[model samples]
Target: SQTIHQWPATLVQPVGSPLSLECTVEGTSNPNLYWYRQAAGRGLQLLFYSVGIGQISSEVPQNLSASRPQDRQFILSSKKLLLSDSGFYLCAWSEFVAGAVNNEQFFGPGTRLTVL
Candidate 1:
C-alpha cells in the first residue's frame, strides 16, 4: 500500500523565521510528487512537483523552494517566512503514467502553518 506522510500537523511561526517542511512516501517508487498550499476557504495552489529524484519543478514564483533528494522524499524550505505564506500545506503522490489523464493522487494529512 502506498502512503504519504507530512510532519508537524500544525505550526505557528513568526514572520521572517526560517521554515522546513518534509514529505515522504512509502510503498512506491518514482511516483510523481506535488506540493500544494490552500488558503482558508480558497482553492489549492500548486507550489512544486517532482517526477524523480533531483528533478523539481516550481509551479509558481514565491518565497519558497523544493527539493527531491531521494526518490520518495520531498522537502519544502524557505529562508524567511512571510505572513502570506501561512496556509495549509499538502503533499500528494500519484502513480506516473505517460499520457494519462486525471491521475488520482493520495494526499497527506497536511500541515497548517500560521505565520504571525
Candidate 2:
C-alpha cells in the first residue's frame, strides 16, 4: 500500500518569514508529486508538480517553489510568506507507474498555514 506523509499539520508564521513544507511517499517509486493550496472555503489550486527529479511544472507563478530531491521526497518553499499565502497546503501523489491520465490523487491531511 502507498501512503503520503506531510509535516506540521498546522503552522503559524509572521509576514515576510520564510516557509518550508515537506512531503514524502512510501511503498511507491517515481510517483507523480504535487503541491496544492486551498484558500479558505475555496477550491484547490495547483502550485507545482514534478514528474521526476529536478523536473517541476508550476501551474501558477507565485512566491513559492518546489523541489524533488529523491524518488519519494518533495519539498515546498517560499522565501517570504505573504498574508495572502496563508491557506491550507496539501501535498498529493498519484501512481506514476499507472498508465492513466486521470489517476486518483491521494492527499495528506494538509498543513494549515496561518500568516499574521
Candidate 3:
C-alpha cells in the first residue's frame, strides 16, 4: 500500500520570493518520483523526475528545481518565483511494470500556488 502526500495544500506568494514544496512516499522503495505542474484549464507539464536518490532529471528549463533528500521524500524549490509560476503542482510516484512499457503513475492531491 503505497501513499503519496503533498503539503501546504494552497499557497500565495509574491513575485520574486522563494518557494518550497514537499512530497513524501510511503510503503515503497526506490520508486520513480515525478513533479508536474498544470496551469488553469491546461494540460500537465512535467518539471522534474527522479530514478533514485540523488538522481534527478529536469524536463523543462524553468525557474524550478527538485531534490530527493531521502528515499521516500522529494522536494521542489525555486530561488525566485515568477508570476508565471502560479499553478497546480503535483507529485507522483510509480513502480516499474514488468510487461507494460510505461509504468502507471499515482499522483498526490497537489498544491496550488498563486503568485502576485
| Candidate 2: Cα lDDT at 99 | 61
Q: What are the runs in model 1 whose C-alpha is more than 4 Å off?
A: none
Specify the poorest-scoring 10-residue window by lDDT in model 2: 95-104
Model 1 TM: 0.95
TM-score for model 2?
A: 0.95
Q: What's the count of clashing pairs in each model shown?
A: 0, 0, 0
Count clashing pairs, candidate 2. Answer: 0
Give per-model TM-scores. Answer: 0.95, 0.95, 0.94
Off by over 4 Å in 2: none
Instruction: Give candidate 2's root-mean-square deviation (CA, Å).
Output: 1.1
Q: Which residue pairs show collisions in model 3?
A: none
lDDT per prediction? 0.95, 0.93, 0.94
Q: Top lDDT: which candidate number?
A: 1
Candidate 2 per-residue lDDT, tens place, 22-110, comes to 99999988999999999975999999999999899999889999999999999999999999999999999988865677888899889
**Predicted candidate 1 versus true structure: per-residue lDDT over 35-102, tens digit per residue:** 99999958999999999999999999999999999999999999999999999999999999889989
lDDT of 3 by residue, 1-116 (tens): 88999998999999999999999999988888999999995999999999889999999999999999898899999999999999999999998555667778999999999999
Candidate 3 error regions (>4 Å)? 97-102
